[model samples]
Target: MLTLYVDAAREPNTGLSAAGAVLIHQKAQQQFKSPVFQSLDNHAAEFQGLIWALEQLTDHQDILTVYSDSKLLIEALHKHYAKHYQDQVDRILFLLASHRLVFSQWLPEKDNLGAHNLALQALKNRQTND
Candidate 1:
């Protein structure tokens, strides 16, 4: 089973945002973090992390389980429960259906520190580079 942990971060003053993900697949692990273009809000940034993680999979039969700290992202994906970012929510659901998406759990923020830190780092990097 492939397990992915995803998170997002934003700079309040600059409105800069980043998405991060840690993927555990087979015996290997992959990490990704990047600044989001167009400076999306927290919800869109967080959902983009999951979308980016899902896009990393090349196999259609791969079983994927996702862990996130964002309740909005989880509920949006699982329950179709987002009013504003319905497009992102629908896109994530489509990706989930393409893969063997089994579990989408909401973990405590502390439990998702790896991805969280990565997101912060990405945001910082974007600031520094710009």
Candidate 2:
């Protein structure tokens, strides 16, 4: 199965935020990370990471699972129907359904450490580049 770990961070005093995603395919032992600029709140950053991950996926019908540390994001996704942030939520759900993706929430920063660090790093990099 392919597993994806995702996280997001917002620079202090800066409206800019970044989403980082790492896809790990156990069998192949491969990992991929996508970092993107996001213009939203923390929750929105989390959703953007998921969306970016889905967009990077090459297969729409693979046994893929996403691991996120955001409980709110996970709960939003688990709902029977999309709620506020409906446009973003709908797009994520649509990708999940279209790609037959499975998602689960993981607490404890360790589980999502890599992605979390990457997100912070990406944010730092963005700041430096600016």
List TM-scores for all candidates, in order.
Answer: 0.90, 0.85
Judging by lDDT against the true structure, name the best candidate.
Answer: 1
lDDT of 2 by residue, 1-130 (tens): 6787888887656657776777776555434445547555777777877787788777677677878888877777777344656778888887878655576666766788877887888788878987
Give each model's whole-structure lDDT: 0.81, 0.73
lDDT by residue (tens digit), candidate 1, 1-130: 8888999888867667887888887878888886454445777778777777677667657787889999998887778768988888888888888765578899999999999988889888878887
Off by over 4 Å in 2: 29-36, 80-83
Report how far off residue 113 is in candidate 1 (Å): 0.8
Lowest lDDT sum, 10 consecutive residues, model 1, at: 34-43
Q: Candidate 1, after superposition: displacement of residue 110 in Å?
A: 0.3
Clashing pairs in 1: none
Off by over 4 Å in 1: none
> What lDDT, from 0 to 1, does candidate 1 have?
0.81
